[model samples]
Target chain A: METDLGYWIIPLAIIGGAIRVSTPFLFVSLGEALTERSGRINLGLEGTLVFGAMSGYALAHLTGSPWLGVLAAALSGTLFGLVHGVICSLPKVNDIAVGIAMMILGMGLAFYFGKPFVQPVAPDLPAISFGWWSEIPQVRAALEVNVLFLIGAALAVLLWWMLRATRVGLTLRVVGDSTDAARAMGLQPAVIRTCATAVGGAFAGVGGAYLSLYYPGSWNEGISSGQGLMAVALVIFARWNPLACLGAALLFGGAGALGPVLQSVGVSEGYYLFFAAPYVLTLGVLIATSSPTQAMTGAPGELSITK
Target chain B: MPFTSLSRRGFLTGTVAAASASAVPQLGFAGSHSPLTIGFIYVGPKDDFGYNQAHAEGAAAVKAMEGVTVIEEENVAETIDVQKSMESMINFDDAKLLFPTSFGYFDPHVLETAPKHPEVRFQHAAGLWSEGMPTNVGSYFGYIGMGQYLNGITAGHATTTKRIGFVAAKPIPQVLLNINSFLLGARQVDPEITCQVIFTGEWSLAVKEAEATNALADAGCDVITCHVDGPKVVMETAAGRDCFVCGYHANQSPLAPEKYLTGAEWNWAGVYTNMVQTVLDGGTIDNFVRGGLADGFIKMSPLGPAVSDAARAQFEATKAQIMAGEFSAIKGPLKDNTGNAIAAEGEGFAEDDIALESMDYLVEGVIGSTS
Candidate 1:
């Protein structure tokens, strides 16, 4: 309890918390950023996320391998994304409504099929000790990072790099910026969008795998607790940039940790208010960034929300 | 697959509705012995492996009885949707007894529907039956703190560090009471044991629960427990950290057999059977009931491998004393976290004491403030 760095542990804990809690946010928003970059919006990722969690946990329990569980989750997520993509590609179909329908379908399927997997313990994802740098056991435990977190961070950077540098990325950008131009250049907007959504859905599935196999490491009806939907808003706050998604997710995680952090330091007087820190910070971000007078500079021109 | 059966069931239900409306009065009469249908509503997935699962298991037990039909629904929120579901149970299924098993369902949904179906019986979980509430409604709850108190003994001895941790959903009296008992039990072995508690402000947030679990473990709590809707997050997170876990709601030892010390579980199967059997035997159930360990309302899971033999024996002795009616976990001679007297010395309160129901203070030895 004695320390020269007495109160600084709060910030350290928050940083550790941010890293621990933000993997799902990072993955889902990165996925969303990818999908939105090709002029399609998949609001159904929430359903995809929960379904992925269910699939991942169940498969992990059955296969006794956490890696296989992640694969199954991604596959199921891709299936959800494919269905959403195909349905929304139809003439006169509203992508938002289709997304909503997909959400319901995905959740219903997950809950109906996920019954037996609820009580079983899925194999845990391996952890790497980044915390060895600290001598304090508490600090070491706090900093003991999950392997999936590092993968998500690396994916974020790779995704940001690919969006600007790759051929496929250029095609996606052209499709997102202008449909008429994309068609003139021999690009199929629907095809590119569907592929983008499928990719997005796959990433979401991995995020959910992180939920059920790594962090909470259990499958239940209430497991997701709106983390998937929160990622949608987080994507918006990140301005559809994959690299920014990482920072935004960590920020959100830090905000989520604020209440618990304060209480840990013996400041419990306003802990209840700290529960709202994430939403409050999110609202603050949205207000500061979003204005009627200003266009979303990074937004895809055909993106549904900004349009 | 369901469309054809759905229409056929709709026709059957329509006819049953007509027959039931006319037979409602006669069905409740003294000589009536018509076969009965009962309904159970849940606030979460039926197989949530936690609170709702416990209720569903009890309902399943009721399903095995002869001359009774059990109809159950899951994931039904305590909103207007519950009113409609209750109406369907009465009209379509001809269900005479209904159990809307959620704390939030008591006020508006159950109360509003209770007046319209006076001939039916309503058994609500977490019901507060004041003078104004319906007389046909009965409230039932278990004192699970005794089990927590027992579980804490194993945790108390199992802890290499004097610091223990609890990840709770909210600071409700029921939850606060359990935390106090847990600490008191821990202090029984090691008086210097300090419990760190963090409330997530919501019932079932897995992310927050994981983060809280890690935070508690990092803060040096070797033995961690929880009083959330589900202890899945706490159990898995703690086990992941190589920390010993004490579970809640149902027996969660199965989740982490090696790491689990013991669990506080609700034995609703026996309780539900007893309640329904009374109704089947032409007895009324319109009373508030609270049962302790002896009554089989609250039970403890078997001690896990992590617990030492001495701790297990100590826990069993305390359990035996409770079952023999010689011990009460909520006894006085206690002080709140703010150093206020909760129970004066020699002024012990029983486990079922009403004062324990409204417990708003943290007991001494708890590290965090109640607020």
Candidate 2:
């Protein structure tokens, strides 16, 4: 069986892993993209993601429903987003500074409250078996896609469409592109940006739910290996587009899985080096896509990173 | 801004007071009637269910002793923060004996701090205390690989797939020893059994650990175990996937009661209590200390419900042999996975042999590379 299966296992495992690992990335980047589309950067999504994971897991363990856990995670994320937005909206408050503070606060809250939930087992989110016809157990396991991944994918498409062809999208763009124009249109830029950031936080919360409810499927202080923070980079690589964010997340997931997939195939030489695949991929993609000649292709006009 | 300035002045005054207070403990406190104060610092939370928890349990045992006061600082980093913690313990808490339990606390933190406080005995865990180091500094480690071997015996008997998985943090010698021993112990049960090992390249990465556990389960490894800082993620993930698990570092049966077979645990409670008692009796601990199952330094967790009667019988018998020094996990007639000779026929290294400490190769039937 080892000899016969050796040829295709690597690619098969990578594909399966890409689907499983990308859920959190997809959710966070989508949320980040939405926030950045309104000219705000929420770096605290890392803390938000972690806090959501803890709250979701704790709630799920107590309530006996993974779906409710997911809801609680999203709500907690929204609360975090609202807090970040409200604080950033205050006069003389720097969004980036507020974001950094929020990140620390979110993680601190999660770790403090998350101590008791570490040992208890919570109900896991169910997955749809797409490879039921396959007799190979690995194939079946790999094809078991979680429901959240599908929701994230659909959300990406819906978001992309909403950003392109809707009145609310146009208003957000106006508020993000030019504060004067937004006020000229009788719109409150703070109110619009705050709402957008809150929705983005909701997306990030669902992403956190993905971590503690599915995939790795547990809660701990180390559950996230900077994936929450990585979403910001991922959003930039995706050119602030929701659809592109989906593809970029899958790419990151595939790179992250490279080390373990190689080890499973008996390629243990330079094993530690393979673990650097995701970071290398990130650097390589950023360097290749970035230009020194002009503004980023789709950066929001008032975005702090671009300005 | 006003509050910040006030607090900064208060901190400076406190530091001066603490510096002066530190001298009291060093002045004839050893032979005096005062309680011996011992300080323990952990690199992570006290209840991490892994490496730090093992030490914390030991500290708890020492805390319960008569005429002994334990001062513990959890979540202390391995950087300058550890040095600061050591200083705080000595200067502010008046601790005469300090146990900086993290491995990274040894090199610069403990070494640099030990000299400044000659009266304080700084003992580190899992560090090699060579000559030329401060006389006040000592090191202690356990032959926990023996416990892993027993875990392997339980896992081997429980596994129906004839395959087992090991999730390791790194390819260090100490970790390698445990992996090899686990494989060898399983091979004793069934020669055809092959152990697949996956190195996550980190001590406490929950995401990678979970992914590795899932990959192992997907590859048909019915029994899974791991050597990481915290086995909570691996144990829970494996149990969720219906895979039997053997734990490492601490008892994890409570996490997966039904699926848990057995576990390799560090009996630091006994080691800590003994060291504390010796100090209280006006004695000094050895500069370098090491012990295995026979010396009560490491132990195996009680066999879980999943362990069959036959498996438990073999496990107990082999454990008895190990304790009596009649059995060696790294015995002769062994080869590396690369087919190179590790030990020829009728040759073996005892558990405490310095040769075993430098182990760099995985044994045959273990599917992994050290590099």
Candidate 3:
């Protein structure tokens, strides 16, 4: 019996997998970038992401509309972000500590609420097939991209423009760079930071929705596998640039797909090692970019890590 | 006259109870004096439709008993957290027996905690408990490879492409055994049939499982099955791609009814109930207990509507042979995928063979590498 074992399947599989896997990463990092740019870091986006995935899946299953699920997820994420922002706005409260607490709370709440939605199938987000020109099935499957991913790609560009070319962008940059300067400028740093964090959380929630309502497409307790936390590292790797976040997410997704792609083509040597590609890439990028004597470029001046 | 008669009846009941208590002093510790509290801890959600769910079903069976009270904790990590859970169940819940149903919980979590609570019994699933381990700690596992072999038979008949796929979590011995058995079962129908396997490297990565399933479908594998913790994603993904699916760990027919083939399901309910019953009757279970279909440790899911009559007949016949100990999945004259000899001619290994436990290679007709 003849088998279609060819080298061509490797590249196609990886490309398709990267697009599919990167959607959540793209959103989470973009959200994290927005939050960090306002001099606050929401490390609890992992929890927010999971909660969003759960709520999004549940609402989609209940309403029979995938778009409604995304909206519900975004709303839940906004609420989670607002809570984080309000709590961090208190005097003497540490943002990192609050973020950690919020992460646990968010995950716990998601698991509790997500129990009922695990078995039911929610409406999935639609995909636009770009492989109509190709006769090959692999190519068609590879080019069949989810709409959420395209939206994420477009959001990345929009965020880049807003952060660089808008009046709101300048205020955010000023507040992130220096608190005293913001106070002198008559801008309430706490209020601006809180609002930024809330919006960032909304981005994360959408990312979660993509996980449960599109790719892999289910509401399970283990749906989000640290993609939320990895976005934190990815934000730094991208220099807090939204466009860079998009590229970095795709890169991570490709690295993640490397193991399974090779195995598909009967290349199983160092298979487990290939699964670690994303984490290794993250560590490698972080090590390569770090400098002991100076703050990281593009890092917010008032960001707690830098301080 | 009524008071005198009631007193006489109470005296007779007391005499009988005292006689039985003295006769079975061994049962004095549990179930006789109070309800037996059995604690169950899972590494994931109880309704995951995979490994944890199978064990949770077992716990449910134990829960249904007369003198048994079951306590359950889910989503507990396989770290010191499990140890804390075991300790809490022992102290707070007064649990006398614990089933930490994750392989990772055995090494230090169960080993360290078992010695501290010498009176409490700890039975871990899929862990190899040796002689040197704590006397109170034991291990139990089902030879689900037999079920996988049966799954392969059904998959082989269902496949029009003559190609099937297996999405696995790791290349561990147990997983490798399942993969080999699945392929071997298919080869029984048509020796020309081939299986391609993809390992996702984690037990519960939903996205990776989906990607692997798609990769297989793209490669033209019409019948797909998996050994992941949760087969829900794989089943759903395969069904979405219009591929026939064979399930693992638990019944996944509800997830994909139309495309569903039969599945390999763990029958832990019987095992758990029997263990609890033994403890209730003042009998002790073995330190290391293992069983296959014959012993009721594992079972095959009902054949779905897609299974052909020929396939059903073969499955039932093979199942009967397995139950009667007349057949084995790993037979003689077998070779690894690399063309290396795995078994000499006339050398067959039964389901309980220790040699089968250290499997490090994929069988012939399986297009994948163990390394």
Candidate 4:
């Protein structure tokens, strides 16, 4: 009876949580959308994500500026991505195998380097107060959005536009649609795909930066919680669309927040089940939105793996 | 040092990486081939600053000991992964002693591996080893609940609002018992105190932990503690919210020294050193072992600057009583979260007593349910 008002607070908590949690997802999925749009599959972004997290957290702890940490994370992510891209560009290299190796390398490097950062606290990213109108404390806290969330939202729209309306976007779309066509058009498929992969890695790095600089921001070996892998699924579910990636990220964030939100309201009954609610719902959405015939509706024609 | 067997020759295939890593006092036995080989399996990373870290510290102590070589394989889950890790350590390394330090690995993995390698001593933490278990399979755990009790005393005095928050991994007996002990200790200082708990159904998920800490903070809980594998995320989030934090397993003071009040810590150095020494002495380990502050297995971290001197003094006094076996957190006249009585008349329990293992219900001051 005491927690009856939990129902009302749960939505607000989720709204706040979604924006907070979705920042990483938004960045990762957007990066992934760009990479996938270039006819390349970099499954190793998980590794890139974690490396970004470790480097970002460690650098933030050192520089005392969250933005520098973000910059360093993006750079490290770019390096890892470049390696994966070059290796995949080899005559006989399998993108999947190289992706897996890159993931392992990224995690191992992060683990080895992140050992020092396990105990230290880093500087926090600044937040914007959107809840000034609300007198309720919960609403105020929930509405205190991190600046990265705003940047991610704007980037998603910018990416969606750039991918359709820009020459570089046209070149990327052409490469992703057909290697033969890209080569025929003097686009140099490998070069464009490599650049796209590098750009994608930078985006993932920023996502990791958001995680360590803001909400639940700390660098630990287990910090990512498969968020990197989940972002890949999110991109697929979003049909590789940047705007849809934003929506999908928020959805996933809300789902991840479901258990804690319910617990806040005192529904201890089936509490264990509540924690599983997010994953179950995410899977359901992924399954429902992805269909047998409609699976590749907006998919690039030249993407080797998808074909 | 006694040689358990000559067949253990060339057992370990790799060099001890922790030899340079550990600075704690050790025996450092000479003759590489003659050294006693030991292995450890962790459910999570050794740097977790929590349960796994505590055990790793113990293992590190063992590594420093004379005639002992330590091999550690981390992130071994409770599933078949543990079995592979155990088998590899036993077969490839010929580890004479094995400490699989996760609760879930006990019945299925340790139980399956122990009887098969009777010559190899198997020591498990948070496991129930009895007649049903192999003699070589020993169980050892610390009375961390007592430390929690003491920390609760500190929390009670420190809290402006007696609303304490608990972020737990699961409602398993180990976690439930610790929560009860923490509440019991908090209520010892203030009878009106209440603890709201959230279980994330995971051993370690940092984001969920942060969200839970935020939720509890919004719900007006100013003091927070947790029983997850690692409490770093909880401590970070709690301190970020300007709430007082009670750490678990290891001291997270470095994470938030200003906000940290105190923590319930596990000092496995005693248990690990004793086990290794016992084997070297050609003696048998107690099949079931439980230790507390009296034995240096469970310890309370130094009180942070945030705690008042009076609170520290009171907690110290209570801790002394616990160490002296004069105070029992679980005794007669105890009741569950519901109206039903949990302890009947004349019920008695000690700090490290095995009788406290069946803790399934929340105490009166607890604000959450068991289900």
Candidate 5:
């Protein structure tokens, strides 16, 4: 069959691509949000994503339950983040460098431990159908997205509410805004950051688990495809807001899905250019939203990256 | 986190000094019996429809044979940790035969482990360790040149610019040999064909592979081939970019079917089956068994539909000549990229010089080093 996309395919592809890309971004950006809210930035979550995928796939294969893989991934991710937190908490270590180091360490450990699990056929996460009520095909197609998509949406709303309405959220915001201020209020900065990192790591881990245990039910080196790194970019584009993170992730996902959608319409030429869409969009938004003089509008004050 | 029970069992009693220690001897080792356990250690995550996947396919084939159990560890890193993994299989699971399937693992790990466990057969894929006069270890590889040569032929016939490119992980002799064969095959079709080669110095880096492929494409090399893994990015990147690629180690025609000409494919099933049969029959596992095209171990994938029938016929005829020992692909009035004669006008490189295992130079058009 010819690889082409008629005009009709673009809208559906947009819907499909948005769903596909948003899940990984949602998980990662939310994790980054939580971590940043607790006064830490984890560049190492990318490594956690891959290691979590490996761990999750291996565990699910061995245990014959996908949920076990999810749990394993979350646990592995938390362990990695804990290590990152502990190392950065040292007297003189830079959090950014420690994050980079943890990224490398996490990847090495994943490859080392992941060697035995390449082509395992683990039980994938079950999908929930919201398309049943929608009679129109486009709406149905959009509604029939992965269960994680809805969960991600719900999570965004929950996080937005939490940050505005909850005591714990206020504590996180306090920590993120000013470590000195947090210490003045009798809060332990290290402990808060460590716990936040752990929670963020769990989110990153579940993102990885989604890769091997849902969309692609096997572990391989190329599974993550820089999704973890891109998620980091997505967080900045979303301005550290969880709801904004969801919208940004879906947009990134749609961009990513462009190549396959185009190819389906008999547009095989220059497919690689399409593959660069997500990165291009990420870079564009990053440039558009980020301000050199007024970082206050777009980023948290104490965030090292923004500074 | 790995299976806690494995570490709890403490098969690796010591940690600091793995290289020097004799591997713990295989316990309960006896002659071949009903249920033979074969352990496969892979370097890459399987399922690229490429090298590791081909090996896994072979493992699956061997597993189907009566009374054989295949255990595999995917994505094994090339590190000191492989020793611990080797120990787990030999000392803990009692694998009768071990396939520690990467070129880097040949030294230190395989060489060290061989003397320690004389009973268990060690069959490494694509290393120079022969069944050294009956040492229960064997090294096997295919006439990948057969496939490389075919790729060359396709490149020769198809290139509009007549400038071909090769992206390799390293300039090691094995990779060099493929480059040489590809050049030789292309030159055989048209004498003026020149090749340009670049080495990424690391295997399986999608971004780097893409970069190398792009650099070649930008340098006016319209046709390309690679000794790197996951040419998915390379081929896909080159798609609609006015470039054609001959893939290595798998049937990657589908990835960029329009632009893909043909590729070198490993028939892992052949070597794996032979090793399994040898282990099953209680035959002495030689120190190394150097297998080439004759053993059906190395072969080319089917040419893409784009290849002209005339070229395909010529490829088949040349393959037969190589198989018949009438002509070696590297037999030559050979020259390096500079056109300096490496081999005499009438004589080709000796079997020792240009064989599958020890090739070391870029052919007449390549622009890189083995180191």
Candidate 6:
């Protein structure tokens, strides 16, 4: 019951929780970041997430490796996104509505396929301990973290650099800013948006895989608690920046750890409020950062929700 | 050997006579009756290792019995779909005994369906309807508190922190009953033992279950139990974290071998077999039948190998005491979460009382709102 905070346990818990909670948000937000940069919003990532989780877990269980689960999740998510993109490419169908329908279909399929995966003991992802030098067991325990968190962080940084320096990023930004501008530059807006949506969906699917294979080493209907949707909200909070998404995700993680940390220290009265902290903080930040005056003031001009 | 041997003509005649003799009893039985057919409808997929699976397993047991034909329709969502499904089973399958096994199916759909099939017997789970009360409807549920109490003892004795957690799907009466029983049972071992309850409000979500477990673990709860469908999340995550856990609905020890203590299991085979046989015999349908440890309907699964022999023996003794009426697991000195004494000392809960029926309060050691 005694936690030596100075021994790096608290620091590790903060850092570890940040990584654990942020991985899903990182993938989801980064994917959204890319998609938004390409002038499209795929709200269907929630469905993609649940479906990818089911596909990944089922495939992994069948194939006997967690990495296979991730691959399967990505492939399934990409396919789902592709279907959504294709359907939304129609002349009159609203992309948001298609996204909603896809979410329902994805969840239904996930639950349908997830029936056989109820009681499985799937392989878990290996954790890489960054605090091996610490002699204290507490530090070691805190430092023991999932490797995906690091991957997500590194991916975020790489994404940030790509957006700033890469030609693809420039094309995506142009496509996002104005379809006319993209057309003027001889770029096909539809093709870029479709690819962006699919890739974003793949990231959401990976986030779901992180849930099933790393933090929780099994699949069930309860594997996600609105994390897919939360990640969508997080994208807006991060303002479509990959690096800011990482910080935002870790903040959500810290907020998530509050109830437990307080309860650990014998505080128990306001646990429900603590449970709602991340959502509240995200909403607060959104309102604080965004202006209501201009339709597309802070957001990319062609973005759906902002415009 | 020579004496046993018969001539070819005599052997042929004897074989014919033996076959006739066997056929006569069946002929007499069949002359006055139709073959018994039972049907089962599950709310979720039959593979959902919790409630639906338990119901399906019961149906399977009935199917194995002689003269009983069992047909099942899984994934029967509780809607107009149920009415249609029931109609198909009744008209096409000729099912005389039907079990619509989900709480959601108990309302207007069943109410409408049960009366239309007057000749058929309907045995429902969790509702308080019965055939004699209304021609051919019956209700049955286990006193799961019995098993929960036993689990509490194991958790209470096993836990180093005296803080146990329960990851419940919803705050439904059934789940609430288990939580209350678990807390009461833990309190019996140590009055100071506190139970933190987390409700995901959805049935059988493993992601939420694991998240809830991690939350509880982070909150310093060293032993966890769940009223959820599957125990994999709680069992797997708690292993080597020095946390003890118990399964629900089925034996999940194989999922987390060393971490499992014991679980409350509903042994549906006996209930299934008995109900099916009653239909086969063309007996007058009983209004309702409650099956529990005494009837061998409800039982605690085998303790995992990790449990000490002493804990196992203690559990067995407790079971025996409960069976013998020498123990009332929910007997009082019971107090509500508000410190109000609900049951006086040495005064056990009356079997017919409303405590189990309208269970809506947290036990003394519970640290959450029942609402």
Candidate 5 Cα outliers beyond 4 Å, as residue runs: A1-38, A47-174, A179-307, B1-34, B130-134, B338-340, B350-356
DockQ of each: 0.51, 0.44, 0.44, 0.58, 0.07, 0.19
Candidate 1 iRMSD, 1 decimal: 3.1
Residue A3 of model 1 has an lDDT of: 24
What lDDT is reached at residue A200 by model 1? Answer: 95
Candidate 2 has what TM-score? 0.93
Q: Evaluated with DockQ, which candidate comes out highest?
A: 4
* lDDT value for model 5: 0.73
State which candidate, 5 or 6, has the greater TM-score.
Answer: 6
lDDT of 3 by residue, B133-189 (tens): 999998999999999999999998988888999999888888999999999999889
Q: Write one digit per residue (lDDT tens) for candidate 6, span B257-345.
A: 78888888888888878767766665754666665677777788788776777677777787787787546666677888778887888
Tens-digit lDDT track for model 4 on A146-212?
9889999999999999988998888889999888888899878887888888989998988888877
Q: What share of the true interface contacts does candidate 4 keep?
A: 0.67
The CA-based lDDT of model 4 is what?
0.84
Residue B43, candidate 1: Cα error in Å is: 1.7
For candidate 1, write residues A1-307 as lDDT tens digits. 2122447767877888888789989989999899889988888989999999999999999999999999999999999989888887898898888888888888889988998888777788898888787677667766778889999999999999899999988999999989999999999999989989999999999999998898777888887888888898788889889999999999988878777766655677767888898888888888887779878779999887777
Candidate achieving the largest TM-score: 2
Quote the lDDT for B76 in model 1: 86
TM-score of each predicted structure versus truth: 0.93, 0.93, 0.92, 0.91, 0.63, 0.83
Candidate closer to the true structure by DockQ (higher is better), 1 or 5 = 1
Itemize residue pairs with steric clashes in candidate 3: none
Worst 10 residues of 6 chain B by lDDT: B1-10
- Top candidate when judged by lDDT against the true structure: 3
Please give the lDDT score at residue A95 for candidate 4: 82
Q: Given candidate 6, what's the lDDT at residue B190? A: 82
Candidate 6 residue pairs in backbone clash: A222-B205, A222-B206, A222-B207, A222-B208, A223-B207, B130-B137, B131-B137
Q: What is candidate 2's lDDT per residue for A1-307, written digit by digit as tens? A: 1122663777877888899899999999999898888889999999999999999999999999999999999999999999998988898888898898998999999999999987788989999999889888778777889999999999999999888999988888888888888899999989889998999898898899899988688887888878999987899899989999999999988877778878876888998889889888888988998889978898888887777
lDDT scores in order: 0.85, 0.88, 0.90, 0.84, 0.73, 0.75
Candidate numbers sorted by lDDT from highest down: 3, 2, 1, 4, 6, 5
Interface RMSD value for candidate 2, one decimal? 2.8
Return the DockQ of model 3: 0.44
